[model samples]
Target: MENVCLSEELIKSQVLCAPETKVVIHGEDCSVYKIENETGEGVITRYPVFPGIEILYNDIHMTNGVSHNEAPRPNVVEINHCRVGRFECEFSRGGSIYLGEGDLAVNVMTNITNQTWFPLSHYHGITIAVDIPVAESILKQLSEVMGKGLDFDLSAIRDRLCAKNSCFVMRATDSIQHIFSELYRVPQDLKDGYFKIKVIELFLFLNSPELVNKREERQYFSRKQIDKIKEIRQYLIDNVAQHITLNELSQQFNFPLTSMKLCFKEVYGSTINGYMQAYRVQMAAKFLRETTDCVTEIALKVGYQNSSKFAELFKQFMGQPPSEYRKSFVQ
Candidate 1:
């Protein structure tokens, strides 16, 4: 049987065909897929860079998770780079892993599960999917024509990074950041050509033995643990006006203190204190813009008793005092 390209397979999947999804084709080679759920919506734009190789930009802002039902194909490899926010991937084999800002993950399609979502309710990332056999042949032909040794093997890279059917994650490095940053900033007119060059450059970078050898070993949390951690997150968000200690959370949620700290950070990409601090400021900003509440009232609403301290933290996070922030939103 002829190989079906990864992009084609994804387009044929029910997830993309569901009532909540809207697909808009820009041209023969480019398309945008939008998804809406009760919580929020997500947009994915895809460009076919080369035969059997495609690039997708995923911009998701939804609290509710999306279920995937695409059958796994071992011949396909997916490369994901998390530009911002957190991606919670649940594997069919068991357990879940997270991709935070600047992180890179490479895995076979077979390892993906039916459930995948963004932990922080938002994620912006890039995905490069390669149909190994077809891509390899195309790359080889291009190399011969260009007279440059683009002899990197996609399958070998997959094997090296994803041994044992496990996803390989690499923490953000300077080189990785540089490559992706350029991709993110490419001019609209230059996108097509720029993407082709960058995608080739990306594969070459991945082919490095030194890089793969030093890949980070990320921790995976069980479903039950992830549920409890999410519960703890919701409880904290629901009661942002109150101060809660880690010890109290551990006892209240029946989760160990050490694991709670570690897993929470892993899943949400921030410590509990850090996450709450940011959340409070975000809520305060919302109130400042949407409500007539005074600074002190707004501060108290977000659990700050001292208006001065609230102003200080607000400036620290938002680059200006709350009063100024609110005024800027005014006429």
Candidate 2:
């Protein structure tokens, strides 16, 4: 594993770079990469668990998007867990899949398209990338010492999960969630050793026969449909002060109401009403913090005519009424 430097190899493979990316090496085994554009910025902190394997924490906040012209890497497999927010993965074969909160995806680096973006303009996730040959050699030695029954075949795992160069995505079950939840809270002192254990556990979990056979399929939306959905989202945000129905949106966007509803939920991880309600509450909160507007005025500005109804919804989403919430923000 020591022979293969995962960070250096990933940069060389062009799998982790964009024209906007700036790299910062923290140490021999750790690095940080930042991607910035007109919309926002993203920071990726990477740590090598072994020579051939690495873990990256991706925190991206961007409105526009980031473009990457990554070359094919048949020997690399990436496992992604979406802790929060939404991730859109477009494949070279023309369809795109979304990974919402608590979703996991495994795909060969060769299958990714040149474009990837966050549907919500913010995303937090973890990615574990393995260099097949190097990982295989190291895991073999570890397996021999651990037990003869241990299964750690990187090629077989990749083939099973990412068949025909397609990504495998599924909702994270209890077991998978347990594994990843611990990863997010690892103690600093035991970070390196803990990551090694977790990576091995993740591989073993993926290699399980039950997981391979019983995994559910996720929907893939066309690029055209995704673009339309994004446009619909932007329109809603721009017109947040107005009341727009699904039918109205359908006519305005020239998209079918049924398909728009489904695809919009899939891409943004919420139904239109649900998403907007939350968005409205979020805007109200921002106004409360940044502006001196009274509760009723702020509520009306966010499209709620009735202050009482707005207060109810705001408390439901923010766990407090507007007046109280605004007070907490006071210095």
Candidate 3:
């Protein structure tokens, strides 16, 4: 059996397809599953594709197998834009897989021939991270700049995708400054449209992308506090696989649990537990992106007792099943 990986631009903008142009896996009996958004974000529609078509937003990765169907149950919080979809499917192939995502669906191809499978489980979507106060305030400030007579706002854009700008704000306070600054300068009604998403993309492109390491002006915490945070960060780096409780961390660091939580907020811009979980998923993502290890092995490596739990958590964080992700990753 042969498996081909693809990463290509599809019919829709920002909708990425992976591994191969046409979806063909190892087997003809292997199948493609469709995940559709009947309504737009937060709006439930009877028919799933009513929301506007963006490959990732309304689309899902397709999969079917006969062996394991339960999903991981990791908590994923979203303030504005983006979703982490969770599916509990039981029967799936036990061989090499094919993966793709686009405006319509997530295509999975089997590597084996004439593979028949069952859909014993279902998938649920998890919302990603967002900073409401900040996003709203920025939206208001930007809207005031645009003269808020229109319906669309930066808040809406951030909501549509469950944007993760908290980390961005931690490093570049002004990362959003450009978007807000220029957005305020734009015509009023333009704010009604997706200038928010545009601003997000601008920030993502300028400060967040891996290829560009532009140094932006930043604000650091007080010196004494800074040292404490460095300790915490190092601890997390060293213990990414283990369970870290706030109380334990506080006792070791000599701060009251409350103070410790505040410090983590000030430094990382998210709760400690959320940070730990996100960090764990990120580490798991690294393994998925870099290794051909089975999901079970990766789950154990990331401190998950069971592979299904890891898969659910991974889906909630990255929006795809582990097998699907691995297929695209190796290719």
Candidate 4:
């Protein structure tokens, strides 16, 4: 398929095509735009919550295939957090980064072209977009209100972003997660006002001296390394029943132990064992729902020898014991 460059106009004409999708305008520049797949199981909605701030919620599954899209937005900054499945992004210059669950990617678009892809055809997350000058003004007003110095240099951040080709991906801190969690729970009627407050909170957290300094020190990986790590991930998925260790994978793939550990975590946002355990549980859940197998049989199929251990892990991942989880469907 040919790669398409997405503009504001394209989002309306090409992307939001499902019959149930709708756009509501509140005022001149404030609007709520919603899009969904034909089944309504996947949806993406954007709310222009403030004059220069926009919040987008995504709960979408790309059942068709992978989508390769390019976005060219000038003088805008985007904060993308992956709360569920991971997504892969490629910069205009062949740079790539992956955002996994609880990971945040902050990027500034100033004459920059960035492309995004859904590796697993599923994503659920929130995106925050802010116009540069507007965000700067908001920060100043907030500083005055709180009586804290809140010394922030937006220009400096912009310079750094430009230096790095307008992208930085990091693990989401607890403070960041808390603010977003509160925003997610805010009542629908009060969303506009609450969004404003929460966005200010996000700015304060990002502007802290510690975070600002951390941004300067970032890891850069070669494209070759990223591709190799992705291959290793697929290998793990294919052999979920086998007990794969780091030493074994390193020797087989010819990757240094340290590089594999670091890159794997960056790409998948979890330790090797954690990622495998989560993936294994997901496979087990599929068996529980689709097949008539007993709990012990299902556990052994997904690599667990002890049925009791499998039940415990399944509860941790799926929030219910296997029997109860299956019963909910039957009842």
TM-score of 1: 0.93
Q: Model 4, stretches more than 4 Å misplaced?
A: 1-42, 62-74, 111-114, 118-121, 133-157, 160-166, 216-218, 244-248, 306-312, 315-329
**Regions more than 4 Å wrong, model 2:** 1-6, 11-16
Between 1 and 4, whose lDDT is larger?
1
Q: CA lDDT of 142 in candidate 1? A: 80
**Per-residue lDDT of 188-306 in model 4, one digit per residue for the tens?**
88887888878777766766555645543446677688778878988998888777889999999999999998888766667888888988998998998888999999988888899
lDDT of each: 0.83, 0.83, 0.39, 0.67
What TM-score should be assigned to candidate 3? Answer: 0.36
Higher-lDDT candidate among 1 and 3? 1
Query: Best TM-score goes to which candidate?
Result: 2
Q: Model 1: which residue pairs collide? A: none
Estimate TM-scores for all models: 0.93, 0.94, 0.36, 0.71
In model 3, which range of ten residues has the least summed lDDT? 97-106
Q: Which whole-number lDDT from 0 to 100 does residue 80 have in model 3?
A: 14
Report the lDDT tens digits of candidate 2 across residue range 1-331. 4343456666443333465578875666678888788778888888888768888888889855556667788998888898988888676667877788888888888886556788788988898888888788888888889887565678988888888888888886888798899999998899999999999888888888677665667566788988999889989899898999999999988998888999999888899999999999999999999999999999888899999999999999999999999999899
**Best-to-worst ranking by lDDT:** 1, 2, 4, 3
